[model samples]
Target: MADKKWMPRWFYQLASPRWCYEITGKLLPLFVIAAILLLVTGTVWALAFAPADYQQGNSFRIIYIHVPSSILAQSCYMLMAVAGAIGLIWKMKVADMVAKCCAPIGASIAVLSLATGAIWGKPTWGSWWVWDARLTSMLILFFLYLGIIALNSAIESERTAAQSTAVLALVGLVNIPIIKYSVDWWNTLHQPATFKLTERPAMPAEMWVPLLVMVIGFYCFFAVAMMLRLRNEIIQRERRSSWVRDLIAG
Candidate 1:
């Protein structure tokens, strides 16, 4: 017999929907607990403990929500596009399912970012909206997410829908960089990124620490949401499978 090929155990497990479902079930509770703890702690720390900005004062507190939502929106879209690409290249149904679940969550997060930005903008700029480069690009990203969701739902064939949405997601990947660099590339009203990997934060630790907590909490929340949606997708698509049937019966 020919020698068996070597593959990572996770690679094999990822190819199995049942394994994905089971593992997500095991992980979901932990993520949920972590999200709740982190979000609550962060919210309290941001609102009550953190010092107000010298410039924006109490209004700056909205950063706790806006910054995290904006970061998560972009991150979620990246994950969705990457998952879609995996589905396209590998023909993995689980990857497609994950990509599908990402759209709605990402869309909602994008909206939250925009809404909070508007609220923050009113005090900072004396206006609710601006035709700034970053804002425009972020709006475009939101539309791209909606387009993917609409395309997926409009197609009749599941495989065709997956393929089409995957292509759309891959094409839309260009917008992410535009959104990130818009402020720097153009004379925009939006401020530069507050947190950069290479430099110290613009704000004091008292402000940035809670923001960091909120960011981590948001990621945990996304994981919890994504896994819940993926689990539901697995059950719905695998309704006829023996394991799923047994699970339902039990």
Candidate 2:
């Protein structure tokens, strides 16, 4: 059993819906603060401080929002798939709840990514839309997120919905890499990644630093949003339990 002393206490606590709710309730404020501070600072820096692109000029500023949304959408989808797999393999209800909540948040971010991408393209490519591989793949990812959400709502049984959506999330995992590498694998108008870990950033520190801050802020925002949803899911799922009743009563 995972109850051995070698196992971490928090690892065991993750299996308990009540523990997850209480812990997230404690952590949500911290994440919210971080999200607000970083987002405000990054937005100011990106808009007022960062130098305009020589070629694209002010139009490039959209990247501060676009890049973070794109990255977060992919990350959120991966997390959803992994959480669903965990719920399937281990029968963890908390994990199931978490996977369920990830859908709408991720879908919203995906929509933001697409919208910002289109806006960016209008100035960069002189068109609002194109059949570029990167853009097409991202659209497919957005559709996949929608499909999961639809499948979950269409199913009446909660357990069946989770399992069915979990399988769909797993299958959709194939599109993530496609969305990430489409620029490289095929010739398209979309640009390659500006930030790479193995090499220094192509842009100056003033630009990249704020972008990094925004990326961190976006992740924090996602955490806050997902935790809020997960807590509500926990309460609804565990409403019959005495602890939840006590929590609600008190």
- Top candidate (TM-score): 1
Tens digits of lDDT, candidate 2, 167-244: 999999999989888888999899998778889999999899999999999999999999999999999999999999
Root-mean-square deviation (CA) per prediction? 2.2, 1.6
Name the lDDT value of residue 217 in candidate 1. 100
What's the TM-score of every candidate structure? 0.97, 0.97
Clashing pairs in 1: none
Cα error, residue 164 of model 1, in Å, equals 0.5
lDDT of each: 0.94, 0.93
Candidate 1 lDDT over 1-250, as tens digits, reads 3222675678657869999999999999999999999999999999999998999999999999999999999999999999998888778899999999999999999999999999999999999999999999999999999999999999989889999999999999999999998888999999999899989998899999999999999999999999999999999999999999999999
Candidate 2 positional error at 33, Å: 0.6
Cα deviation at 159, candidate 2, in Å, is 1.1
Q: What lDDT score goes with residue 36 in model 1?
A: 100
